[model samples]
Target: MKVPFNSKDREVCIIGLGYVGLTLAVVMAEAGFKVTGVERNNHINDLVNSGKAHFLEIGLDARLEQQVKNGNLKSVISIDEVESASVYIITVGTPLVNNSKTTNLEAIKLVSEGVAKRLKADDIVILRSTVKIGVSRNVVKPLLDEAGVEYKLAFCPERTLEGKALAELVSLPQVVGGLDDASTMRASDIFGFLTPTIIRVTTLETAEIIKLINNTQRDLMFAFANEIAGYCDVVGISAREVINSANIGYPRSSLALPGPVGGPCLEKDPYILSEGIKALKGNPALALLGRTVNEELPKVTIENIQLLLDKKVTSQEKLKFTIAGLAFKGRPETSDLRGTLAIPIIDEIKRILPNVEIFGYDPACSNEEISSLGITPCGNLEDVFKDSSVLLFQNNNPAFEKLNLNSLSRLMRQNGIIYDLWSQFDGTSLELSNGVRYGGHGLMYLYNK
Candidate 1:
C-alpha cells in the first residue's frame, strides 16, 4: 500500500476508536489502506473488533463489518500490537476540565506519548481532536520531539454532525494545517484521497481556530434566538413566529429559531474559542456571551415552566412531568447524549419542583438508554402524556411532529401544558380539551398568562 506521499508504507494507526477515529479508520481502510485502530477503552475495542458501532449512525455498522471481515481494518487496544505505520492519526476527546472553560488535553498528551514510542522517520501525525490554539506545537510537538525522530505533524479537525459523520467525512472539505509546509502538503495529500476538496491552511493554529469559531458562531446565533424568546415572553409574543416571518424570503436577517442548543461541539467549543482568544490578551466577549446564553437557556426555560405550573396545577402530591425527544438534536436523529440540554433541564426541575414523576421518551434511543438519563422510560406516546402535568419537547425528532397531540392532550390532567422547544406544532390547528394548552418554546408567555 502506497500513499501519494513519497512513502511506500500505507499502514495507518488511528488512536481512540470513538466517533471520529472509528469512522475515519473504516473510510481509510476502504481507500485501499491497511488501517489499525487503537482504543484504550476495552468496551469500545471489543465492539469495534466484533464489527459493531457502540452508538447509532445511519450506515456505520454495515461499513464497519465489511471493513473488519475483509481484513482491511482491525481494532487493537494498544498501538504496540502494530509493527509499523506511516501515518498515526489521533482522534481522542478533548473534553473540558471538570465542566470548566479549559480543555483537558490529558488524552491528547497520552496518545502523543504512545505515538512517540513507535515513532518513525517521515511518519505523518495528524491531530483530529478539537483543541485550543498552540496545542499542536506546544503540547504534541515537544512530546514527539523527545523521541529524537523526525515526523510530520498537522492539525486536521473533524467537523461532521453525529448522525451524518460517514457521508460528510468523504464529502466535506478536509482542512489541514501543519507545523511546516512539507507537513501540510503531506497531510493534504493523504486527506485528498478521502474528499475531492482539501483546504490547506498556513499554520496549525489557523486550522485549530476554524472548528471553534464555526461552532461558537452557531452558539451565538441560537443565543440571539433564545434572547428573542426571552423578549417575546416578557412582551407576550412568539419568538418563533417573529423569526419565521422575518426570515421568510429575506436574506439579510437569517435568524435561527429558539431552542435548547446542546450537543458535544456546540456546547463546548465556545469555551475553547474564548480560552484561545483570552490567552492572546483578547476578549472573546461575543463568544462567551453566546455560551452563557445557551447554557442558561435550559435552566431558565425550566424556571418558566415552574411559573406556568404554579398557576395551572393545584395537586403537588402526584405530579408527573414528561420529557420527549431526549437526544441532543432530532432532525437527523441520533442516540448520542453527550452535551444534551436534558441534563440541566432535569436538574432544574428536580431542584425547584418537588416530588415530580419524570418520564422520558426518545425516538432514537432504547428504554434502557432513556433510563440512563435518570428518568422513567415511557412505553409510548400515549403512556408519556397520560395524566402528565407538563410535557416538554427537548429535541426536534420527527416522531413528535407526526403525533396527534390533540388526542394525546385529552389524556393529560386539566390545564395540561405541552411546550415544544423546536416548535414543531402550530397551535392554530390544536383543539384543546379540559383547558389543555399547546405552545411553542418562545410563546410560553401566551399560556402562562
Candidate 2:
C-alpha cells in the first residue's frame, strides 16, 4: 500500500474521547498525524489536555503523555474548535437504553450532526463506533447528506480489546467498508499507516454486521459453556473436567470456559444484533437465548453461593465474604467496570444476606475506586483472607490464579467456603482440606461430598 498523501500533512479529528476514541487518537498521533480530540465533558477535556487518561489500560498513560508532549495530539471541548481536518472519525458510545435492550444512538446522532456542521468537500468521514446494522446508511448518511457536503464516508468498526488497544491497533488487520469505492480506498489509506493488513469489504452494512457477529458468536459460545456447567452441577460432574477432556487432541470441538460474560461489548452487542434481526422480521432466538444465559449468570452465581453457605455456615449474620477481581475480563486485564457482573453479584449477596459483611479486592483498581462502587475495599490479600468465612473469586485475574490456596487457607476461618467462579482452582481436592470447604460453578462433586 503506497502512501496516497504525506501522512504528516493529514490532520485527523476524533469525536468523543472515551476509551476507544482516546486510544485511537494516541495511536494516530504516534503514527505521525496531527490529531485533534473533541470531547464535550469539561473534566475529560482537562484530563486529556494534562496528558492523563481517565481510564486504565496497559501502556495508554505513557503513550498519551508522550503524544501530548510531542504536540501531535490536542483536545478541545467543542467541535467548533476543530477548524479543518483531512479525516473525521466518530467514536462515540452507543449504550443500551434505560430498562431496555435496544441500543441508544443519541450520542451517535449528536456526534454525526456535529461532524456534519463542519463537513468539507473531499474530506474522509469514518465511524468506528459499534452500532446496529444499517446505522451507517440509514442514520449517519442521511444526516451528512442533509448537510450538503461532498465527502467520502466509511464504517470501520473498532475491534481492539480494552487492555491491548494500542498494540492491537497496529497489529490486527483493519476492517474497512464504505459507501463507494473511493470512500473505501480513502479509509484504507488512512488505516494503512498503523497496520499493513487492511480488509476491504463490499458494503457498509457488511462491516457493521461483522462486528456484531464477531461479539455475538463469542457470547453464544460462552452461553453454551455456562449451560453445560449448570447441567454438570445437577448431575454431580465437573464441567471444566469434561470440557478439557473432550477437547484434548480434538479438532472438532472448541469450548470456551464458563464464567461471567458481562462486558461493555458482549453484554450489549447481542441485543443490538437481535434488535436488528427483529427489525428485518427475522427470528433471533439463538441470540436472545445467549443474552439470557449470560445476563442471568450473576443471579445463578448468587443462588449457588447461598446453597453452599447454607450447607456449611450455621449463622448467616456472622458471615464475612471477600471477593477477588472486579473487572469484567481478566486475560487482557483492565480497570473498566462497564457492564461488570461483580457489582450485581455484590448487590445480590446483600439482597439475600443483608447482615453479611462484604469486601472486594482487585489489583487493577484502587481501594478508593472500589469503595466508590459501594464495595468495601480490602487493602491486601492478607486482609481479604483474615477472618473471612466465604471467599469468592469473581474475576479471572492472573494474580488470583497465582494465589497459594494452601497457605491462604490457614489465614481464613476454619472450614471456610471458597467459591471459584472461573474454575481457577481444583475444587475436588480442596474439598479434602479440613480448614476449607471448596465449591466451584461446575464442581458438582463438591456439593455431594
Candidate 3:
C-alpha cells in the first residue's frame, strides 16, 4: 500500500519546466507543496533555479520568484538529482515531427522511461502533455509496466491559453482520467490543489480525447469562418457583414468571425487527432479538413496581395512591405511564436517578393525575436507604415483600430495597400486620401462589425 494524497504535504516532481509545467509548478508550490522540476535544458533549469521564467505570463514572474526564493520550488536537469517524490507530473512537449504531421512522442517516451525506473508503490504519475488518444495506454503504460511496480497513472491535460495560463490554471476545471478507478480518485485529489472543480472522466482515453476535441472544435469553427471568408472573397461580398448580421440577436447562430487561425493548439491538434484515429484504421476527414482550410490561409492571402500589385496602381519599384501583429494571435496576446501563421505568411511574401525589404512588428514579441526570424524588426507603428508600399495586419490587436489612416496615407506610397487579416480596423469608415487603399481578409469591404 502507498500513501493517500489527502494533504498538500505530498512531494511532487514535475518533468519539463516549460510553459505548462512551470506554471503548474509555481501554482502547486504556492499551494504549499514542495515541488521539484526536472528539465533537460541546462538554461531552463538555471532560469527556474534563479526564479526567472523562460517565457512571459501575467503574475508568473513574481510567483515563481517567491517559490524559488522560499524553497518551495526547485528544478533539476534529471530525475535522479532529487529524492523520490510521492507524485510525478509529466508536462513535456509533444511537438509534431517535420513534414510527417505525426506527433513526436520521444519526449513522452523518455520521460516515462525515467519515471518508470523511479516508481514506488502507489506513486502517482500524471501525463499533462497533449497527446494522441491511447498514447497513455499503448505507449506510456507499457513502458512503465516494464518496471513491475504498482503505480497510479492518469492523463490530466493542461488546457490553458498561453498568455493567461497563470490565472486560468487556478480556475479552469482540471479534467482527470486515470488507468482505473483508484487512479482516477488519486489524480483528482492531486489536481484539487489547483482548482476546486475536478472533472473526473471514465478512463484515460476519455481524458485524452477531451483535450483533442476541445482544440479541434475550435479549429473547425475558425475553419468554417475562414471558408465563409473565401466564399465572400469569390463573390465580392463582405463576410464580416454576413457573419455579424447572422449572429446579432440570433440565439441559434453563434458563428465565429473569419480571421487568421494559427496557434499552438489549433495548428497541431487536428493533425494529432487524425494521427490517433489512423492507428485504429479510422478515417478522420473533418479533423484533417479543418487543418487544411486553416493552413491554406497564408497562401490565399499572398495570392490576393499579388493581385493587388498586378493592378499596377502601386509601384513595385523600391517597394517596402511590413507585417504587424506577428504573434499567432493578438487577443489573449502572447510572445510565443510556436505555430504562428506569421511564419507561413512571411514565407509566402518572400516567394512573391524575393529580396524585398520586409519588416515585422508585434506588441507582444521583442524586436530581437522578430529579427531572429529573418524579418527586419520595426520600431513603431508610424515607422512600420512610413513610406511602406504594403502593410499587413496579421493579427487582431485592437491597437490597429486606432491608427490615424488619413495622416498615415500621406506617408505611404501612392496606392499603398493595408490588409488586415483579422479586419481589426473599420476600413470603410476611414476614408483614405493620397490613393491609399484599405482592405481586409474576408472581403474588400471592411466593416467593424
What is the C-alpha local distance difference test score of each model?
0.87, 0.86, 0.85
Q: Show model 1 residue runs off by greater than 4 Å.
A: 1-9
lDDT of 2 by residue, 34-110 (tens): 89999999999999999999888877888999999988899999889986687899999999995877899999898
Report RMSD for candidate 3.
Answer: 2.8
Error of 1 at 415 (Å): 1.8
lDDT of 3 by residue, 88-122 (tens): 89999889997898999999999999998998887
Q: lDDT, candidate 2, residue 135? A: 93
Q: Between 2 and 3, whose TM-score is larger?
A: 2
Worst 10 residues of 2 by lDDT: 1-10
1 versus 2: better lDDT goes to: 1
What is the alpha-carbon lDDT of model 3 when measured against the actual structure?
0.85
Q: Which candidate is the best by TM-score?
A: 1
TM-score computed on alpha carbons, candidate 2: 0.95
- Give the better candidate number (1 or 2) by TM-score: 1
- TM-scores for all candidates: the values are 0.96, 0.95, 0.94
Where in model 3 is the C-alpha error above 4 Å?
1-9, 312-317, 446-449
- Provide the clash count, candidate 3: 0
Ranking by lDDT: 1, 2, 3
